[model samples]
Target: MLRIATCQMTSGPDIGANVQIAESLIRKAAREGANLALLPEMFTIMSNDPKDVLRLAEQYQDGPVQRIMSGLAKSLGIWIAAGTMPLKTDDPHRVTNTMLVYDAFGQEAARYDKIHLFSYEGQQERYDESELYVGGHKTVSFNLPLENGLDIRIGLAVCYDLRFPQLFRRQSGIDCFLLPAAFTTNTGKAHWEVLLRARAIENLSYVVSAAQAGRSSCGRAFWGHSCAV
Candidate 1:
């Protein structure tokens, strides 16, 4: 079996601070012999203000986030399935919520932009990710070569995408699913675990999820139970 780890964090608006936390967690996971590590969505920044996210958006290849993840993967000699980060797009008002995977050698192996944007309105809270992010149009999957001379197919997805089973269904022959999420307290408490387990059972593939926990700089509380099944 492939050893994997998922990290939960209380990310804030400071990109540098968040990266440091992620690095520390990744190092811990590596020391424990984890072959792969998955981080939470928006692990580099979490803010309710659109300006904060926009200010932090960077080009996929040239951004500090990518550089940090790549260097960490290479240094630790482990694969890193980085969580969703804001990547600059053609539209200045919007960015892509993208996931980047790095191989042990620090080369980017695959990238998946989040396809489903989350929008919720309730008496307690309201959120509309579409205001800041442009949803991606494609499904992405790649193979991870294991030490046993076996290659495992991994499908990539982000938070809201977990609610859309059709997306996972489109990726056939995947051995596992990686979901990086920042689920709200209300919805996560009600649906997170059930949905994750359902995806694993229905697809007959293992599911790994990393999530943001506790309160964020935006005053939003996240459900922090990052897990795998």
Candidate 2:
């Protein structure tokens, strides 16, 4: 059996501090013999100001964050599902919520951008990702060679994408799915676990999810029951 673990993190607005937390968890997971590890969405930074993302977004290829993740994966000799990060896109002001996968050698294996955008309106809350994030155009997956000659195909998705079953259904041959999320306290209490379980049962695939838990510096709270099904 493959050992997999997901980290439930509480990321703030500081890039250095966040990366340090990520590194600590990665080390712990590696020591536990986890073959694959996952981090939560916005593991780097979460800001109330949309402008912060544009300021933090990096070009697709080279960046300090990318280098750190790649190097850490290589050092630990494990596959990493790096959750969602802000990636530069063609649009000048917007970025892509992307999942970057790295192999044991620190080589990037695949990248999946979150296709669905989130919109919510409540008495005290309002959010629309379309204002800051660009939507992805394709489904993403990668295959891992297991010890017994079994190649497991895994699909990638982000937080809001969990609400859309059709997107996961379209990716055939996936034996497992990875979702990294920052679910709000209100939504998580009502729908998070139910939706995650439904997706796994419907797809007949292993689902591993990492989430942001607790209150963030941005004044937002997340529900953090990070689990696998």
Candidate 3:
């Protein structure tokens, strides 16, 4: 049996501040005996400014952000499903929203770029990520090796990707789906719990989610209910 911890966070544009909070929560999870911990999407920084994405986007395997996460996993002796971070892409103008998973030994385990970029146009709130993020094409999954000698298969997905069932269906025999998200207050209120429940019911698999809730540093409201089932 795997003990998992999903963190509920309220992040802002300050990368340093966000990382510190995440580290504290992760350490707390490890202390509480969580074998695996997941963070919310855009945990690095939920910026209202698009330039922050470009200013901070690092190459997939390189950069200070990646180094810190690897160290946290190794030193803490825990598995970390790192929430999505901005990754530099071939396109100089845009970056790929990427997720990185690290093993207890501080080694890279798997990587997934968010395939579904959110595009929502509400009367009050409008977001078009396509302008800043390059969509990812492939699905990704990895197995967690346990001391019990049973490896658990876990699939990877970012926030908006949860809206598309086809993405989850693409991975077979997944014991759990790791989702990291920061849903806008309006949309999340209408469908967050409903969708999460539906996904769990449809897949017959556990759904673990980390969320960004409340008012962010950017002053944007989020639907901050992190859940696992």
Q: Estimate, for each residue in 163-206, the C-alpha lDDT of model 3 and write its tens digit.
A: 99988887889999999999999989998988888888889899
If scored against the real structure, what TM-score would every candidate get? 0.98, 0.98, 0.98
Q: What are the C-alpha RMSDs, in order, of all predicted structures? A: 0.8, 0.9, 0.8
lDDT of 3 at 84: 87
Clashes of 3: 1
Among these predicted structures, which one has the highest lDDT? 1
Candidate 2: Cα lDDT at 24 = 90
What is the number of residue pairs that collide in model 1? 0
What TM-score does candidate 1 reach?
0.98
TM-score of 3: 0.98
Per-residue accuracy of model 2 over 8-31 as CA lDDT, tens digit each:
999988878998999899889999
Instruction: Give the clashing pairs for model 2.
Output: none
The regions of model 2 sitting more than 4 angstroms off are none
Evaluate model 3: give its lDDT.
0.91
- Whole-model lDDT, model 2: 0.91
Backbone atom clashes (below 3 Å) for every candidate: 0, 0, 1
Tens-digit lDDT track of model 1 for 86-121: 999989999999999999999999999999999999
